[model samples]
Target: MSTLDQDLASQIERLRAEGCEIIRSEKVSGASRDGRGELEIVLQFLRSGDELVVARLDRLGRDTRDVLNIIHECESRGAFVTVLDPHVTTRGEMGHVILTVLGMVAQMERRFIKERQKDGIERAKASGRYLGGKRRIDRHVVRELLAQGQSVAAAARTLGCSRMQIYRIIGEAPPAV
Candidate 1:
């Protein structure tokens, strides 16, 4: 069998050995996307003894707040969460503590990434090499559209952009001939 099949078979084997019955197994389809189908299944079907199993904690959420909220919501409904790869789960007191620490680390990591990105942008600007982001709507096109009596909102809609972009283009465009 394939690696995924083998892994799933083993998980089923382990869960069954631990006296747990498998009711349904589902796949979450996207990275950092809401697992709508998986969540609906859990909230709709899980009983008091049921465990919501995932391959990893990140599968449950993109950050600490999201993960904690998911855990709280599951627990409030009398269901527990089980993460398999490292065996961290919401099934015990110690698991909660570990999960909390891991979640905090994830949140801090995200903050650090954003700060690094901002620092990089500032350095680029200081070096006189930063020319802002690529223009979404061409200023010439915006000016032509405006000269043709198009409204700012209409120009934004035509350009698949926002009013802010239209306003910026207006500020940059030279006087009409």
Candidate 2:
């Protein structure tokens, strides 16, 4: 298994040892709630006295507002949130204060990471070492195929890209087939 997968498994094992009955995990980015179905389910099914545990505050969310919103939602449903790394919980008012500070720190760290990434990209561009992402589909080839009267589906199949991508390259809507 990958390092992240192994780490998640280890965390789950540790939680189980600590008597945590239910666990929710997802491999998606914590940058936003989009595509995080597991988290949604946990929030939806949370009951009074229930606890939402995460390996770290950042694992819950990278954005300060998003993390606070999640914690608020849990609290609104009479559930508590627990972060295992630094060991914070919503069992007391102090926990709320600590979690808010941690959430802000996480959001600041995310911003710093983005800034570092942007600086690195700029340096690479200056050194002529950055070429951006490699083209997955050749627009010329896609255009030629479409000009040859190939259906959008046929072109997509030939190019190993989605029809949406083909349409995007051709700069036209999909013709009804």
Candidate 3:
């Protein structure tokens, strides 16, 4: 089995140990070119006919639209998702309402955080106090490793950044024109 398959199998095994009945599953690689190789595996697990079990809502989706779509899909299929850590369980009418409200709040929080970060960045730029983040790992070294047939995962581990960062750096090089 491939690494991805193994990882998913482990996740299913863990969920089953916790008494969840996983009906279906989809292994979603994270969005964006840079985020490739970052797995966001999703499973539709259930405890009973009316109760769906999820380790976390973020495991369901990252964005509000995606989360709502998943929730609606489960509801249409007569299933309600419950998160373990937050202790949020959605069973019926109240469940739907609570999920909707929580989705709205989470979206709002994301927007607010983005705005605040943008404001801080702008302020720091005006004051000339922000030098941006630490310099990224050398792209020349990255290219050397890739040319030597080293995998992105190995390169990322050596460079001390995520696989996503390695992809991003590789993507930014000037294309032959």
Candidate 4:
């Protein structure tokens, strides 16, 4: 098995020891940095009296507001969130408060990451290492496509992009796609 599978196995073991039963597991392939998996599994699948388990609280979200919203949604449905690492469960007032603080810290950490990325980008731009990113699709090509009797939506599809992107490249407002 892959290392990721092994780690997940260990986390599941810990949760199982806490009297938690696994119903379904989803391995989200998307960046899922936005808690899509958590939302889909916890909000959509689980019912009242169900518990959503995660290896870590941060795994649920990257922002404090998002984390709180998810927890609130679960609580409203009578479902609880259980974290395995530090073994915190949102079944109590104290745990909810602690998770709130941790969520804020996670949000702060995310802000720091974005700030550091922006600084690095600025440095790279100054050193000419970045050229504002290259456009794989050309504006002239979009105009040409439009000139060829193609609709804005068609041009966007041909370019493997969105109509808004095509409109931006073509420098004009587009009809609804």
Candidate 5:
């Protein structure tokens, strides 16, 4: 198994040993809830006595508001959430307080990470070691295709880019045709 899969398996085994009966996992980023189908399923399936457990608070979300919203949702449904790493649960008032603090810390940490990354990029650029992202489509090829009388849509299709990119390359607004 891949390293991520192996880590997940180990986490599952630990939770199982901890008496967790139902477990769900997803490899998607926890930055937002936009594409977390497994999390949604668990939230929807929660009952009065059900407990939602995650390996860590960050596993729930990186945004403080999103994490609090999730905890609130679970509480409103009479379900509890547990974080294994810090061993906190919504079974008591203290847990809520601690979770709120932890959520804020996680959000702050994300911001700090972004700041550090920006600083590193600045340093690399100053040293002439950082080039921007690799080019995905050749501007010359796009121009040649358009010069051959291809439609904006057709040129975009041929170059695997957007029609707007083709329009930009040709420096003209889209024709009414």
Candidate 6:
């Protein structure tokens, strides 16, 4: 088998010996530093029948509600999480308390960061320095693609942009024949 498979096998064996039950699930969504890579990793762990271990709580989830829900679901299934960093585990009362505090702190940090970013953006805009991001595909081109009977998804794929962006441009475009 592949090296990753072998390592996963070893991890499963270790968890079984620790008297821990593992059940993986994929009903989750989140963002990551690499944009869309978090979904892939979460899917991988979910497919492996593993408890989805992480070195820290933030490594497992992005938002407080999402994190708590995942933890609750995992626990309800007789599985437990073992966070290595900050040494938090969601298997007992103290662990639950610590996890709760950490989750709240993470959410607060996210809110603070968002507020700071908004203030910076407003300052930049006031100074006429906020040019926003580059326009990947022109609005006229997006309109033409839609006029050619292309669906939003297809037009976005053709233009190498998001469906939301396609919709935005299309909304600004004049009525297509």
The TM-score values for the models, in the order shown, are: 0.60, 0.83, 0.52, 0.72, 0.76, 0.63
- For residues 1-177, what per-residue lDDT tens digits would candidate 1 score against the true structure? 898778667767766665666545555532343656756666677678667876656556647877888788789889898877578888889999988887777677777888999999999999998899886667888888999999999999999999997887777748568
User: Candidate 4: how many backbone clashes?
Assistant: 0
Model 5 over residues 1-177: C-alpha lDDT tens digits?
899899889889989978998888999988899999999999998889889988889989999999999999999999999999899999999999999999999999999999999999999999999998887877778768877899889988887888887777677544454
Which candidate number would show the highest lDDT if scored against the true structure?
2
Candidates' C-alpha lDDT: 0.75, 0.91, 0.66, 0.77, 0.89, 0.69
Model 2, position 100, has a per-residue lDDT of: 94
| Residue-by-residue lDDT tens digits, candidate 6, 15-56 | 466565643323233423234454445544553234556545
Q: Candidate 2: lDDT of 23? A: 81
Ranking by lDDT: 2, 5, 4, 1, 6, 3
- For candidate 4, the per-residue lDDT at 103 reads 83
- Each model's backbone clash number: 0, 0, 0, 0, 0, 0
Candidate 4 lDDT for residue 28: 49
lDDT, residue 125, model 1:
99
TM-score of 6: 0.63
By summed lDDT, the worst window of 10 consecutive residues in model 5 runs over 168-177
| Candidate 1 vs. true structure, TM-score | 0.60
Off by over 4 Å in 5: 1-3, 134-177
Least accurate 10 contiguous residues by lDDT in model 6: 24-33
What's the lDDT for candidate 5? 0.89
Which of the two, 4 or 6, has more TM-score?
4
